[model samples]
Target: MVAALLAAVSVAADPATTASAGEQGAWFSDPVVVSGQNTAEPGIEVAPDGRLYVNAPAGLLADLPGAASFLWRSDDGGATWVLTPPGLRAAFPGGGDSDVAVDPQGATVYFSDLWVGSSTAAVSDDRGNSWFASPLSGVVIHDRQWLATSGGGVVYLAYNQIPAGVMVSKSVDGGRTFVVHSLAASVLDRSGCVCPPGTMVVEEGTGPAGLADRVGVVYATSTGGVGFARSVDGGLTFAQVTVAPARDGIDTTRAFPVVANAGPGQLVAVWQEVVEGQRTRVQFSGSADWGRSWSDPQVVVDAGTPLFPWVDANGGGKVGVSLYHTDQATLPDAAPDDAVWFERYLESLDGGQTFSPLVTVDPTPVKTGPICTQGAACAQDRELLDFQAVAIDTDGLALLTWARSIDNVADTEIRFARQLTDEATTAAPTLHLHDAVGDAITRPLPWLFRTATWSPTGR
Candidate 1:
């Protein structure tokens, strides 16, 4: 039965396409500005009811006393957005890194606010109108915090704990309270850099019987490698797996690896590494049996210097990866140049086996020069922060949020872009079924359809 299912959804015949020099006829709608003030390091999520939510640190708003992160909601997709009321202070008042996640049933929305030495998690049931905030108790000094949710009121918060390592806290009673679930990484794994962990995802256990839902996270290890931690029994315990071994040119400070679930027991990891000639490329690897093993790393984009890569997957083998790309090959400390940077996206219909032609989400340059990698220490060109986010909605349309620097120094704003075409229809049909023997199975049907295009206004 397993062999039959694999044959039905095989994507080996689909050839990979090269990155095109021209845009694909407005494949992505014009980016809509989502923030009125300067904000960086944006994160986005789509609730089950199709409501969109974006969160970021209160950049200029932080100057005001008792100010927290910013939250924006959109009912009419990405066409327009409304900012929530200001001064929703968390436990720490001083807002830093921000992340947002919604429960599987869309009954609750979770948001994280990271301050200098600690962090807080907020929950909202009636959208963003009201929120109840609680301080995360497991970690004493939290650097960056990310949220992930699954069925049964399960929520996982992953973050770096000062000089220790990566820690994950679980909240089974909605987001009211949380306790340390497990240590994703140890002090030995972190070496000395308290690098932030990538996005966290809860993979529904739709495989054989007795298999429970799994929570997975990826982060940069001290040995210059990518580490993946998986918890099969909810967030009770996690076993770390080395997705990619130590490499010579990997910059541990900024080498944040992101993981996404394409299907049951199927995971993909994407990160950035410097090549032989000092050119940085986005690399990805795939695992069919959860995080037990991973395929050799493959280049997703090598034409330009890519930074802050993010990945998200849906359906059978459909995956989307987004990153900031620039043609100039300059060092991080190089002076500001005329080089232009844009946000680029690539999709895969067959899991991570192959990818389609690169699509520029926005033609406008987000930044004009070198981006400072030194956190909070760089004196210039640090407006656009470290990471951006990408989410595949229920309709399989990609939604992206990132910070754009207008002056390349301090003036920054949050912007959003959405895929205009219905890429989900073009892929094979995904079906989850139970075998005759009673074990669960997931596979794609032998059928395909032409791509359909739509505009944001029509939706």
Candidate 2:
């Protein structure tokens, strides 16, 4: 019965061809709800085999014994998905935060879950069929943990160690166990904002000679800036550098910065900064020489207040960023009744040199109420959670997954939007939604299944 229920919940949607009024370019397929259970703070990654893996707090499945989080796998790109529960919550049953990472060869997939004072990294060798868990050491308190993998058996995990700043752990035996490698940042360097480290990446050392594979991470700095820490010696020691300096009125406590490796030593970082205490804007800076030097920060989007900025790059200067955006100039707490928030995306074909105009990935409003930035302490309306994720797929198109609030009910579900390419429009894949037991689910179609004319724009 449980398997049938899970199978019944699996759903797939055809790409909507007609662009809405405000959605002029129609660069992305219409948003599709991928999770039937309540889940938020989604993390996404595209495997080498073109499979999409997403992890989030188990939500409704929290009561299931040992169920830490839900791993949603999409074998047919983003059209259909299947949920696999990772029963890795022996220590902390109530899952806190979760992240997903795929190794280079796509043979090993890593999912890290955070508990109250500890965390677990679960490894799946056969995709998401089964997973073995391993505890992460080197941190007294674990908050938000992120995983990154390189060639060989190397895996790096970074998380917030509370007042002690961000700490990193390394796994040499294919994530079987992790040992403390080094501190990405100490308390002295940060402003005491228990902000978790942003998306971590392993540069494959394809740059200049003598440049070994470098592991890099970005975090909030003490002076409302973005601090980057990189280790070339395999996490033994790290050198920290400032990608962006302090801005006078910017708030570092809520500003989380994210970094992505464009190619070799080329890196790009993006963060949100409050302006005049009224609104927030997204800004980005690029580093051509690893983390040693950074370009002056430039505004990526200034029309409205943006939150939870995430950046991902796919080599050769191709970069993508996703964020929760609202046209209201006021903070989320002060949003008016008509204020609506949507998932907005921007692309850069030439690294961070220039960005395309902001494209609304989803026509649906993700949230309509005050979005509390206070983590874990918020009393109401915290459904959207901390961040949404964007990953460049094997086809070099953007794939985005985020949480959408359910009619201001304080509950949220995962939604996915895929960038539409010329090939995708001509040959739309048949939709296939399945249940946990791999049974197909058939249902009446909606407008999402309707076909219309769509032209590739600005690709």
Winning model by TM-score: 1
- State the number of backbone clashes in model 1: 0
Clashing pairs in 1: none
Q: Which digits, one per residue and each the tens of the lDDT, describe model 2 over residues 1-459?
A: 111111112222222311111453377777778896787888898787777888888652265345477789987777778887554434434366777788886567887776646676778888878877865544657677788887566778888877777788887777778864578877776655556777676765543321356887888765677788888866667787887787777765574678887766677788887766778777787777777777767776667667888988866667798998777667865777677888888776656654555667888888885788877787877888788989887667788999998877667889987877543223323435444366775543221222343222213
Query: Whole-model Cα lDDT per candidate?
Result: 0.71, 0.71
TM-score of each: 0.85, 0.83
Candidate 2 displacement at residue 182 in angstroms: 1.1
TM-score (C-alpha, index-matched) for candidate 2: 0.83
Worst 10 residues of 1 by lDDT: 8-17
**Which residue pairs of candidate 2 clash?**
7-435, 317-351
Clashes of each: 0, 2
Residues 367-444 of candidate 1 have per-residue lDDT tens digits of 987887677787878787788888888777789988888877788888998877654554564544333344655566
Regions more than 4 Å wrong, model 1: 1-22, 60-65, 86-92, 190-193, 204-212, 332-336, 422-453, 457-459
